[model samples]
Each structure stands twice: as C-alpha cells, then as structure tokens.
Target: MGVRLNGRTAIVTGASRGLGRAIALALAAQGAAVAVAARTERVWNDKLPGTIGDTVADIEAAGGRAVAIRADLTDRDDLPRLVEQARAAFGPVTLLVNNAAFTAPGRPPRPGATRAAAGPPTTAAPRADWPPFVGTPVHAFRRHFEIAVFAAYELMQLVVPDMIDAGGGAIVNISSVASRIPGAGPYRDFSGGVLPGYGGSKAALEHLTESAAYELQRRNIAVNALSPSQAMLTPGLSYYRTDFDDVGSEEDFAEAVVRLALVDPQTVTGRTIGHRQVLDGSFDPFGP
Candidate 1:
C-alpha cells in the first residue's frame, strides 16, 4: 500500500491507446477501481494487453477492480455520460484524467515566406509554413480548441460537483512539453491535417487549471496540469512523428500520476509539471 488507491475510483479519458491506456492500467495496478474510456470497440475484446478491455482484465486479475467503456472523450455529449457511468459501475469518481486532445487542421504557420515578408513564424514540429497567427484559419483554430481545451473544461465542470458531493477528488490534465516551451508549434508531418484548435485550446487549458484550482480549493478538489514527457519514445508521439529526445516511456509518466493521485489534495493544485521533474522526484507529484 506504499501508494495504493484501494477503494478509490478513477476515470481516464482517451484510454483506447497510447498514454491514456497506460494511465488506466497503472491506476488499476495500484488498487484503484478504474474506468477506462475511449472510442474503441476493441476495449471489449480482452485480447490486447494495453487496451481498455485488457486494463480491466489486468485489474481484476491482480485482485484490483476496473471496467472499460467505449466513449469519444472529445464529443461534448460524452462527459456527463462518462461521469454517470463511473458512478454506476464503481462509486463517485475521485480521480479524473483529462487526456483527450485534437489538433486543429489548417495550413501550418511556416511556408513560402520571404526573408522580410513574415511577422511571427510557427515554432515547433511538423514545421510546415510558419505563418503568423493572423494568417491561421479561424475555424481550424476553433476546432482544435474545442477538442483540446474546451472538452477538458467541460469534463471538469461536470465532475467537480460530484467530487465535492463525495468529499474530495483529484484532477490531472495530461499536457505536453510544448506548453512549457511556448515557441514550439505543431509537428510538421502531422500538421497537414490541422491543429489550430489543439494549440489554442491547450493555451486556454492552462488558465482553466488555474481557475478550477482557485475556485475549488475550498472544496478540497485538486487540479493540476502534468507535462508528462517530450515526444522522445511514446506511441502517442509517433502518431505525430515528431522527434524530441527527452521523451520518456508511458510507464514513466504513469508512475508519476499514480503518486499524485495518492497524495493530499491541497499540495498539488494548479502546477504545470513536466515528466523530468514529476518522474525524477524533483517535485512531489502529489503535492500542491
């Protein structure tokens, strides 16, 4: 029981694969009753090891408790349903991982700019055309924001009351290292689709964490943004094909989250922590 979460309940979004999948399994392994949610029917199959279904099986097999649900975390309708589902399957959800995100599709900020023709260029990966923010499409930006930041806000808004009703809860927002380095833009290869909404939304998500933490502190709810890792070696990062040598394995990130979930609520609210610090124990993952 070093950091076990026995009898506690956790809901992890984006649990179909990648980081979301890892978070769910790790929590289950720690004795928390977990609900793995994502839009994959495969979660029901029990064949794959890291799938939502497999996480549930792993939890039960280890004498822990868990369940898997197929839901698109980005869809607006899915939030309340997800919360209710957890309440029904386990009890009040005391832990939440706001992990799903979408990149808005638009022409990247870098492309065909003359020596003196551009203002600000895109700074990060998939370094397409580094156009100024003014040049980026409004709609594409909105789409990314909806999925990355807005959806997360919605989930938090819905879940907090329940956590209050249940006495307390912990909220972890799975953010990227990009947030820490404001200059990096989207991945160039993956930017072909678009992520205006994604980047813009995450920028907003930082504020949401602040607001959520400030207002809910009185209620004993903890809100924190965890910069899990760079895109060094994660499957989630491979989806973008962006390279950053500092990225850690999903297990590395998961371990930090588990430690945070078990800590006291007051110590961890509103921190923007990176895997470097969170995993290396520079900062107490559970402390505010």
Candidate 2:
C-alpha cells in the first residue's frame, strides 16, 4: 500500500543535501509537513550543493509543506530548539528521521570557502577521509558518537512523549553497513576503509534502535535503523571517494525509509535492515 501522511509532521535532519534532502522531499511529497533541519543554509559551490532553504523551497514548489530549520546537531542545546520549532510550526512531530552524521573531523564544510578562479571558484579546503585506527584521535570517536548516536538518542527522548500522547509515531535512524563486524578470517579490504569511530558509533546506534524499539513497541512507536545496501553517490561520498559505481539512488533509499516510517510497531520495530532488504521484502527482523 502507498504511504499517506496527510496529517503527520516530520523532522528530517541533514536535509541540506544528498540523501537527507531526498528523504525530506520524499516525505513531504507524501503529504507530511516536514521540518528540514541542517547546518548549511546556503550552498557556496558545486562541491556542496543545496541547503535547508533549497529543500523547503523544492517541497513548497511541489505543493508540499515544509520549513527550513538551520540547526547544528553537534550542539546539545540545539536539539530541544529543533524539536520545539517543528512542533510550533506543525502539530506534534510523529515522524523523526535522524539522517545527520559527522562524516568529517571538523565543523561541516563552511560556505564561502571557495575562492574565485580564472574559470570557476574552487574550495581550497582539503577533503576529509577516515584514517587508520592507529592514526585516529580520541576526539574523532567522541564526535562521531556525539552526533550519530547521542543526538539521535536525545531526539528520541524528546519526541517519544509526543508520540505516546498522539497514540503512535515512527523513528528511523540512518545507519551504515560498516556497523557489521567482520567474521574471523583473512579480512578483505572490502569497505574501502573502515574508520573505527564511524563504524563503532553506527554499531551503537543499531543497538539503541533495538533497545528503543523494545521499550516503545507497547506505546506504538516504531524505531528502526536503515543502511544502504551499497554506497550511494551522495555529494558527501563523491567528495571523499571517486570510484564508487552501482551505488544505490537516493530515491530508492528514501522510499525504503518511508516504508519503515509507516510500519506497524508491533510487526517491524527494531529492524537494522538494508535498503534493498526493505524494498524486496527480504528483511527478517527476527532472524540473525
């Protein structure tokens, strides 16, 4: 059955660009009033395109309802305000898509970082990449967990009350395939390069999903984690790796999210399934 979210309100973080933006648009297209949250308010160059305003504009232009919310998810104080702004703009928030992640080491790519050149402006900033565990610092792990794990947990705590009061809701935590630990043997360098911090934080997030799902199921709140079956050609990914092929599309990923968002808590809660798994009906939530 197609999803219909005429009266639902949604909060989608990292909606400035890439998969998050696509997810926000998809949800809004389905009739949900979306609060598009992200740190980027304007695009400085082609390297990082689109902004929260751009996302909202696209939704509105398509005859959907959405609001642009500039929020730094790294700030604990911003969490409450984000939820409050969404609640004030629409009614209670019944859909929460925690799609933001700390991919780089420092603050997100800043606007105006590009300088005018003879042909076109280019960002002088060096691309950020995951280093070997021995080379990574302690702060890297902390930052990853802070955004990908703690922030999502905090948001869940903030929204569960509303879901409980409104009778039901859904929380979809975007995760990564890196969360899977390799089986004991000669481990192939298949994941490109797995950063301990990013992978570990996602592992924690999946655990959090299961725990929250178990606790909130009785209250009719579905909490699940989703990961791309393969790497997708997001702007962020392009900025880091240039050789990715056969990657999943943002539209397909967004559709999988919508399905999870509309799932019945009693049946599909706590699944850490892949995008293809969700779409193909091969996700066995109860299986190992």
Worst 10 residues of 2 by lDDT: 113-122
lDDT of 2 at 222: 97
- Kindly give the stretch of ten consecutive residues in candidate 1 with the minimal lDDT sum: 104-113
What is candidate 1's CA lDDT for residue 208?
85
Instruction: Tell me the tens digit of each residue's lDDT in model 2 across 1-288.
Output: 124888999999988999999999899888899999998775555576788999999999998999988888778899999999999999899999998987633344445443342212345343555467888789877888988899999999999999999999999999998787553568767765766787889999999999999999999999999999988877766666667667788999999998898999888998898999999998776664
Choose the strongest candidate by TM-score.
Answer: 2
Q: How do the residues 93-135 of candidate 1 rate in per-residue lDDT, one tens digit apiece?
A: 8888887665312211123434233322233233334334676
lDDT of each: 0.68, 0.85
Residue 255 displacement (Å), model 1: 1.0
Error of 1 at 121 (Å): 32
